[model samples]
Target chain A: EAEVAQSPRYKITEKSQAVAFWCDPISGHATLYWYRQILGQGPELLVQFQDESVVDDSQLPKDRFSAERLKGVDSTLKIQPAELGDSAMYLCASSFGRGTEAFFGQGTRLTVV
Target chain B: ELKVEQNPLFLSMQEGKNYTIYCNYSTTSDRLYWYRQDPGKSLESLFVLLSNGAVKQEGRLMASLDTKARLSTLHITAAVHDLSATYFCANWVGSNYKLTFGKGTLLTVNP
Candidate 1:
């Protein structure tokens, strides 16, 4: 089975610093997603991409968070000037198409000190 | 906005028991998914219900969806300690591929 890949399994940084997470989806997948998960809550969607184009970014904090899937394959999520509230597990998922089944990456655990 | 909510945010049960977790959505949807997550880990897909009256089961867990009622249920049969984890139900609403996740049901099975 093809698995979604994510980089920097763990990250620790001071508040107001910059941090970036990378994800490589399963081959042939055309839809990608980014989610933020707090300790005890469900993951919330931060962004969604279809063939390198963003379909939803309503939940993303545009002021500090940015994401791009240039080739509609590998994608990246960056957070500049990270705040304490930004400390959470950032997860990446992808599917062959919208409303299709998706596979999730292990995630990048971010700690903002 | 589509809202997903699960009942009994937390649950504790003994091994060999049975329990069901409810997932309710405020709006209509195309499909529903059940995922399991361990502490500090990524989500593991468990089940996906595609249409009304759809039911799928794996191991001791069974999930059913009712699109008309806008609800889904995950039932555990003879739960085991290994089943202890947080389970979330997410739904696909409208044109977005984004899934709205329920708060999750934390199941703790004591041996």
Candidate 2:
């Protein structure tokens, strides 16, 4: 059972600090997604990557957030000057290809104080 | 712009009872997905409904999709305490694979 892997299961930082989350999709998966899940809401797509190229990032807050999948296998999401409202569960998911069933990682929970 | 809506945001039912969770989408999409999440856990893939009249079942859970109606349903049969979780339905956005998810239905099966 190949699963997406995420690092820093839990993170706590002060507001205005920088934070980063990492994700490694299942091998051979070409589509990767980053999402943010609020406490009681559905996950919101932040970015999508296909073979190291960004396909969609319309919902991503580019002013403070950035993501990169340089090798198209693993990805990194960084947030500069994190804000209290930025606290949420950062989820990573991947699929064999676009429009396929996606597998999600355990997620990285970020908390800003 | 795509939107997914789920009904009965909170449901509490007795163990061994049956219930259905409905998902309605604002646009037409050939692919729809169902996922389950326990508290503090990641999403667990439940079913992938592709095309109209597609149905899939596992254990006591079953899911169906109707592309024309822009609707999907997840039915739980003879549910148990362990079946309690938050269920979400998601579909592709526009011509891409970016998913738009429903707010989710929180089910609590009381024994």
Candidate 3:
């Protein structure tokens, strides 16, 4: 089945270390989303990308978190100085159109010590 | 702020029982989605309700949306042990395609 792809299913790093997560959306999907899900809480939108251009990033912490989608297909979310609170499942989803059903990736589980 | 809420937080059910999960949103929306997640796994799309009074069913789960009321329901009939998972409802906000997820309903079906 066609699915969104995410890398580094699990990662463990020291606090203040740099961490990055990668996602490859399904073919022909134009919208990509990044969400942070903490334990026992719903997923929160951190960023939204329409193709390679960022549509929204208000919820993302600009000082530490950054995301980019190059060539309008693959995306990368980076954290220059990861913090203890940054430990959560980073979920990536893609959809063909706005207000459409989004397909989610397996997500990258990051743990900062 | 647009928000989605699910009731009961957690549910314990016996196999072959019928139950319904409720989802209520805080704002106006025309689209809603239901997703299921197993322990330590990604989300699995269950249903998408795009209009008022939209109803869809698959397997043992039937989902209905009442857009006018800003509510949605996921009903399970004769649920089995394998149906144990976390269910989330996402409400589409405005035109940005951003979805606000509910706290999720954790269902545990005991045999």
Candidate 4:
């Protein structure tokens, strides 16, 4: 079965350093999502992409976070000057379209010291 | 803003027992989803409830949705050690197709 692919299963960075995570959604998927999940909480949407355009980023911390889906196939999420609180599981998911089931990737676990 | 809430944040049940996890959303939505996650792992999609009164089942799990009540449920039958995991229910916010998830219910099935 085709699944969303994420790179660097784990990442550890110093506080204030820059870090990035990558995600490649399943083929033919038109919607992509990046979510941040704390250790004991549910995942929270950080940004959403439809094709190559951003649809909603209301919960994204723009001051230090950025994401892009340049070709509408794969995406990258970056955090500049990462903080301790930024340590979390960054999950990428994709779906065929609205109201469809979104499949999640294995996820990248980030820990900032 | 849309909010999702799950009750019984932690549950400990014996094998062969049955239980249900309830999810309540703050707003109206036609789509609800149930996902499972093991410790130190990513989420696994369980069920997608697309309409009011929609119910789906697989293996030992069953999920139902009530769009009018803004509620969804994940029912586990004949619990087993393999069924132990954190289950989350998410509401699909229509305008942007964003999913708002609940805190999750951590279930531990003891054999």
DockQ of 4: 0.91
The lDDT of each candidate is: 0.94, 0.94, 0.92, 0.93
Task: Give the candidate order by descending TM-score.
Answer: 1, 2, 3, 4
Number of backbone-clashing residue pairs for each candidate, in the order shown: 0, 0, 0, 0
Give one digit per residue, the lDDT tens place, for model 2 in A1-113: 78899999999999999999999999999999999999989999999999999999998999999999998899999999899999999999999998889999999999999
Per-model i-RMS in Å? Answer: 0.8, 0.7, 0.9, 0.7
The list of candidate 3 runs beyond 4 A from truth reads none
| Residue A39, candidate 4: C-alpha displacement in angstroms | 0.1
Candidate 2, B-chain TM? 0.96
Candidate 1 regions exceeding 4 Å error are none
**Residue-wise C-alpha lDDT for candidate 3, range A1-113, written one tens digit per residue:** 99999999999999999999999999999999999998877898999999899988989999999999989999999998999999999999999977778999999999999
* Ranking of models by lDDT: 2, 1, 4, 3
Q: What's every prediction's RMSD, in angstroms?
A: 0.9, 0.9, 1.1, 1.2
lDDT of 2 by residue, B1-111 (tens): 569999989999999999999999987678899999999999999999988999999999999999988989999999999999999999987777788899999999999
Q: DockQ numbers for every candidate?
A: 0.90, 0.91, 0.85, 0.91
Q: How high is each candidate's TM-score? A: 0.98, 0.97, 0.97, 0.96
TM-score of 1: 0.98
Q: Scored by Cα lDDT, where does model 2 land? A: 0.94
Shift in Å, residue A55, candidate 2 = 1.1
